[model samples]
Target chain A: AQSVTQLDSQVPVFEEAPVELRCNYSSSVSVYLFWYVQYPNQGLQLLLKYLSGSTLVKGINGFEAEFNKSQTSFHLRKPSVHISDTAEYFCAVSSFSGNTPLVFGKGTRLSVIA
Target chain B: GAGVSQSPSNKVTEKGKDVELRCDPISGHTALYWYRQSLGQGLEFLIYFQGNSAPDKSGLPSDRFSAERTGGSVSTLTIQRTQQEDSAVYLCASSDRDQPQHFGDGTRLSIL
Candidate 1:
């Protein structure tokens, strides 16, 4: 089984400021890394994914995550944030192959203040 | 034309009552998944279905919970004699087994 832990539970940042959300995983086998965002009363939206290839993977809305194999971490970063970025962020992991279920972290609430 | 959709966006039931939640996946998605989200808790996988076959049900909390997918499209999660702990948001997602999943708004189930 795979497990993920996001370091922060709440992050309040001023708009246009840089932000980073740390995530670490525990798994004996290889797994896929993913980051999803959820707004109020809505389901999650995929932000970025780390399948293979480039260590740094970028996704929608200026979000990026770097896959560090040695540390078993895939941390999401954004150079600048907007107030619209305020939402609950989740880091999830699953097996690279087979029918594996996603194991998610508790969640990190990003409050982008103006 | 539409994304994953779930019926009865909000459901309120008393403890000991049975409740069913429905999920309609994308037209061509071959894989569907069900997850539960409780207050202050992250999304927890409950069951998985791929092209009409299910191989994972380990995340289901107990035997009181069951789910079935028909025609590889629509799925229903049923909770028998629901308990207070059953209150949470139930989410449905669908993919083609190789693509990113699309999710529904989810159905919030509240047990009184």
Candidate 2:
């Protein structure tokens, strides 16, 4: 079984400032990583995913995450955030094989203040 | 092309009542998934359907929760004897093999 942990429950940042949402995972076998964002009253949207290849993966809305094998982490980062970026973020893990259901963290609420 | 579609954006049901939520996946998507999002919480997997067959239904909370997919296109999740704790958003997602899943707006279920 795989599990995800989002270290921060909430983070407030000024607009145009950089922000990082930390995530960690535990899985005995290989796994894939993903970040999802959800706006108020909406379903989740994929921000990015790390299946294989480059350790650093870029996602929509100027967000990126670096997959660290040693740390067992995939922290989402944005150089500059906008007010529109305020949303709940989730970190998820899936099996390396396709069609597996995702295991998600509790989630982090990002508040971008102007 | 249409994305995933969930019917009855909001559903309110009384305790001990049965509620059904429907989902229509994108055209040509082979994989469909059901997940639940409780207030202020992350999504919990409920079931997974590959075509018309569900290979993984382990995530279902209990026997009261049941789901079925038909023709590999539409799915329905039914909760028998709804409880206040059953209040949450039920989301449906679909994807091609090995691709990122696309989600629908979800059905907000409120059990009173």
Candidate 3:
């Protein structure tokens, strides 16, 4: 089984400022990591995922995340945020074999202020 | 290309009534998943279907919750005797093998 923990419940940042949302996971075996964002009244949108190969993975909307193996962390980062970036961000993990369902974190609400 | 689609964007029903939510996965996707989002519980996996194999019902909270996939494309999630605690967003996702899941807008179920 895998479990994810999003360190922050809410993040407030000014527009055009850099930000990082922290996430950590615990698993007895290898796992895949993912970041998803959900806007108001909308479903979750995939931001990025770390399956293999690279430690830094980039995704849509200028978002990126780094998968740290030793630390068991996958933190989402953005060089600059926009007002539209305000949303609920979730971190998830699943077995590397793809046989297990994703285990999600409690989510971090990003509030990008203008 | 169409992403996953879920019907009944919003559903309001009285407690003890049964409700059904539908999902249509993207074309050719062999895997589909169901999740629940609530205030108390953030996001929770409910069920999963992969091809013709037996669906994974491990995440289902209780026997009152059930789901079925027809033709390996469309799925229906049925909730029997709903309660106020059941009010939440039901999300559906689909993906190809070894691919990231694409999500639907979800059905916001409100039990009164």
* Clashing pairs for predicted structure model 1, backbone only: none
Best model per lDDT: 2
TM-score of chain B of 2: 0.96
Report the lDDT tens digits of candidate 3 across residue range A1-114: 788999999999999999999999999998999999999999999999999998999999999999999999999999999999999999999885354578999999999999
Docking class of 1: medium
Number of the top candidate by DockQ? 2
Scored by lDDT, model 3 comes in at 0.92
How would the docking of model 2 be graded? medium
All DockQ scores:
0.60, 0.70, 0.65
Candidate 2: misplaced stretches above 4 Å? none
**In terms of TM-score, which candidate is stronger, 1 or 2?**
2
The residue pairs that clash in candidate 2, if any, are: none
| lDDT string, candidate 2, A66-100, tens digits | 99999999999999999999999999999953588
C-alpha DockQ for predicted model 1: 0.60
The best-first sequence of candidates by TM-score reads 2, 3, 1
Cα RMSD to native, each candidate?
Answer: 1.2, 1.1, 1.2
Give residue A13's error in model 3 in angstroms.
Answer: 0.5
Candidate 1 lDDT tens digits, A1-74: 67899999999999999999999999999888889999999998999888889999999999999999999999
